[model samples]
Target: MVPSPVEMFRDLPKKVCPECGEYIEEQAESYMMECDRCLANKEE
Candidate 1:
């Protein structure tokens, strides 16, 4: 992981899922603030 992305992810106030309160991680620099499971559900 790059220092910047990690820093950015760490700084996000949008860490836990609003709907489910599950913990999540950053997938990309521009990824929506969603967990893997929630993101997949969103795509469906």
Candidate 2:
């Protein structure tokens, strides 16, 4: 059986970012997602 891209990366390690509540996949991604969320919130 082969796992799809999403399935393969589904359980890789993550954390619920306190600032954005996003399931972050990588350390870098967490920072990027946080900034994006902050920008989105500022716009709204």
Candidate 3:
């Protein structure tokens, strides 16, 4: 049986993006933060 990918990181601070109703971490890195539902420019 395949093992489920364990979530390695702790929960980040969440705030919904104005453009998309997706939770985003306050201090999100490129690898860590992204929207699952809609494509939007990641804040730099």
Cα displacement (Å) at residue 44, model 2: 35
State TM-scores per candidate.
0.45, 0.28, 0.28
Error of 2 at 33 (Å): 16
lDDT of 3 at 11: 41
lDDT of 1 by residue, 1-44 (tens): 55788788678685687767887765666555666788788889
- Candidate 2 structure, TM-score to reference: 0.28
Of 1 and 3, the candidate ranking higher by TM-score:
1
* Regions of model 1 farther than 4 Å from truth: 1-14, 27-31
Q: State the weakest 10-residue window (summed lDDT) of model 2.
A: 27-36
Compute the lDDT for candidate 1.
Answer: 0.72
Q: What is the lDDT of residue 23 in candidate 2?
A: 64
The lDDT values for all models are 0.72, 0.64, 0.51
Question: Per-residue lDDT of 1-44 in model 2, one digit per residue for the tens?
Answer: 88899987786666555686876556543455454566578789
List runs of model 3 lying over 4 Å from the truth.
1-13, 28-44
6 in model 1: Cα distance from truth in Å? Answer: 12
